[model samples]
Target chain A: EPEVTQTPSHQVTQMGQEVILRCVPISNHLYFYWYRQILGQKVEFLVSFYNNEISEKSEIFDDQFSVERPDGSNFTLKIRSTKLEDSAMYFCATRGQGRETQYFGPGTRLLVL
Target chain B: GESVGLHLPTLSVQEGDNSIINCAYSNSASDYFIWYKQESGKGPQFIIDIRSNMDKRQGQRVTVLLNKTVKHLSLQIAATQPGDSAVYFCAENIGTGGSYIPTFGRGTSLIVHP
Candidate 1:
């Protein structure tokens, strides 16, 4: 029953400000992912991380976004310059090796004003 | 672009009734599929999953049926309770021999009335 945990359940920031969202994945999980859900829209994949580097990223994951597993346990997503369109719910997910199922965290709601 | 999509936006059912949510996928390369439930403000929670090699899989009171020939998948919940009310999404993953990314559908909201 181990689950991924994210800090700052809700955050509000001004446009052009830098914001960092943190996530602590399951101890034994090997793959980590970040996804965002805009209000009334489908969940969109942002990036996937493995082996301490980015494995893949979507077009939406542009220069403004970056992910890091700095301490092997804390996975974080940083947005350098937030825009109004960046307001959405960011979710962190992780899956163990050889497992296809990804477990999602409660999510950190980010609102760029 | 290939995507996973739901057939309906919302479904209403009475308590104790059975509920069925449907999904469709446009990607033929997808080999893995999953069903997730998302309550109002939370992230998606894994409910059940079925591989392309299997046609049907059951878990607790839920059953997932996959029809690869028609690119269709459905989740059936037996004796649905009020607590079962949530937004359900079906996602498809295309394995690339390395890491796989999941494409999520718009989700179907299930409302169970007691």
Candidate 2:
């Protein structure tokens, strides 16, 4: 089965640094999403992308966060001026058109020191 | 704010036994629900899903039952094996009109002992 893939399984950065997480969604998928899971907390939605524009975003997705399709297959999330609280597991997910099921990737563990 | 939540934080079952995990949603507008399994250090994996229009759906050795009247959903794993041990989460789609944003529950930990 085809699955979403993410690069840099683990990312480490110092405070005030910029980090970009990359994802390659399923070839035929049309909708993409990004979520984060803080240790011992529930997974929270960050943003959703469709048609090269942001469709929806939660309050947690603030000015420091941005997402881009960059290419036909690559989706990226950039966080500028990371804070210590930014440490968490960032997950990339995608779903095909007409499907509500969003399949998730293994996740990129971001550690902001 | 509306959210999806699990009834229990953990459940333990003997190997070959059946396991059931429950979730509750406070959003009445949610029309789609999904169950996902997450092992330690891994992302959530899709298990099964049931739409609001359906009361029950089965897949492989798993069954999902939805009670829209009470906004309750449950996942039943038959003949649970040790490999089935993981944290199970139930997510509800709170968006409409072609936008689907899933609110994930806190997750229930299922431990299967062989």
Candidate 3:
């Protein structure tokens, strides 16, 4: 089965530095999303993207966060200034039309120290 | 609906036994729901889903039961195996104007012993 794929399985970055997490959603899916799971915590929604614009975002998705579909296949989340609290596992998900099932990618572990 | 802190509710079962995980959702307007399994060092994998109109839906070795009256959801696994050991989450799909975003609850950990 086709699955969502993400790059840089793990990343370590200094606080205050910029970080970009990349994902390639399933080719035919139209809706994409970003979610984060803090260690030992529930996964939280960050933002949802469709048609190259943000559909909805959580309060955690503040000024520092942004998402883009720079190409047909790539969806990325960029944090302008990483904070220690920003360290978490970031996951990318995609949903095709006509279905409620959203497939998730093996997450990118972001460690902002 | 959200799980905070370090302790996660855990269930332990013997291999080949059946396992059931339950969740109480907060959204009365949520019309769709999903179950996801996340192993250590991985993201949530879609297991099964059900709409508000359905009471139960079954997949290979798995079943999802929805009790809309009480806002409850449960995932049942038949013949559980070691590979089924993971954190299972229940999510509610809330949509408006044709857009849907899922909200996740703190997951319950399942441990299957050999």
- Candidate achieving the largest lDDT: 1
Q: Interface RMSDs of all predictions?
A: 0.6, 0.7, 0.9
Candidates in order have lDDT scores of: 0.95, 0.94, 0.90
* Candidate 1 stretches greater than 4 Å from native: none
Query: What's the DockQ of model 2?
Result: 0.84
Instruction: Write candidate 2's Cα lDDT for A27-89 as tens digits.
Output: 999999999999989999999999999999999999999999886779999998999999999
Q: Is candidate 1 or candidate 2 better by TM-score?
A: 1
Local distance difference test, candidate 2: 0.94
Residue pairs in clash, model 2: none
After superposition, the stretches of candidate 3 with alpha carbons farther than 4 Å from their true spots are: B1-8
The alpha-carbon lDDT assigned to residue B67 of candidate 1 equals 97
- Candidate 2, residues B16-84: lDDT per residue as tens digits? 999999999989889899999999988899999999999999999999999999999999999999999
Native-referenced TM-scores of chain A, all candidate models: 0.99, 0.98, 0.98
Give the lowest summed-lDDT range of ten residues in model 3 chain B.
B1-10
List of clashing residue pairs for candidate 3: none
Task: Give me the displacement of residue A52 in model 3, in angstroms.
Answer: 0.8
* CAPRI band for model 2: high
Tens-digit lDDT track for model 1 on B1-114? Answer: 888999999999999999999999989999999999999999999999999999999999999999999999999999999999999999999746567778999999999999
Model 2: residues with Cα > 4 Å off, grouped in runs: none
